[model samples]
Target: MQALQSLADNYNYFITIFLMVSGLYIVIARGNMIKKLIGLAMFQSSVYLLYLSPGKIVGGTAPVLDPAFTVYSNPLPHVLMLTAIVVGVATLALGLALTVRIYEAYGTVNEDQIFARDNKK
Candidate 1:
């Protein structure tokens, strides 16, 4: 009962782990280029969530050098996540562009089909 209660209290951690695993599974199990990209995006999102989860503090104010403010939420995690998001977006765009090029060259985005065709030639 205690374990169950603790699990329920820490639901966000479970959700983050689930998303990470599912994303990895999708990337590994799917052969289609678009699906793989979607999985990569999911994986990236999980990381974003993981980073943001701990940085948030209820009733915490910004880190201002003020005597009135005693509790300040750490801004570093949010800043890092913002940069990570930008990098993730750029990576996703590049991946999509490469997938488009691959589709244009092969007329198919399926990994197995591409490999089979390559083997024949």
Candidate 2:
């Protein structure tokens, strides 16, 4: 009963792990460049969750100069995650632009076809 409760309390970590694994698997198994980009986005989302989960405290207050609050939540993780999100978005956009260029050059987004064409060249 105690173990179950502990697991339930920490379920967010498990979810983060699941997303990370699924994203990695999709990136590895999919041949489509768009699918790989989707997987990379998923992995980035999981990283956000991983940092935010531990920073949440049940009875914590904002880290202001308040003597009444003994427990204060750290804001650093949320701030860093915000920066990470912006960077992730920029990276995704760049990746999509590159994908478009790749398709224009190769006429297909599949890795196998691109490799075959390169071999032929």
Candidate 3:
């Protein structure tokens, strides 16, 4: 069927969408700080995939000055994705570090427990 073929052709887009939704759901549904960080990382990874997907050409080679190659994949998106990945890593590290500090201070990573403790104090 046409719809099936289209879905097959755009499977990567489906995967990206699935990851984005699942990551957002995890972030919103979980109470543990570490789980939320994991979800955030998943969300970031989906973004990387989204950025990199369109720059790919089926038969294109890397951007190089070669007369034999008529088509070359765009390198700009890949470069930007690399920078994004680096920033994402830094952000994940900082988030984890903060989670560690919070756990040390509060003795638990559950949001509700932390809020309850704060309310009691």
Best TM-score among the predictions, by candidate number: 3
Ranking by lDDT: 3, 2, 1
Name the regions of candidate 3 deviating beyond 4 angstroms.
none
Cα lDDT tens digits, model 3, 15-50, are 899999999999999999999999999999999889
TM-score of each: 0.91, 0.87, 0.96
- On TM-score, the stronger of 1 and 2 is 1
Global CA lDDT of candidate 2, please?
0.94
Local distance difference test values of all predictions, in order:
0.91, 0.94, 0.94
The TM-score that candidate 3 achieves is 0.96
**Residue-by-residue lDDT tens digits, candidate 1, 1-121:** 9999999988877888888989899999999989999998888888988988788787888888799988888899999999999999999999999999999999999999999999999
Model 1 ranges off by over 4 Å? 64-68
Candidate 3: the clashing residue pairs are none
Model 1 — which ten-residue stretch has the worst lDDT? 56-65
Error of 2 at 92 (Å): 0.8
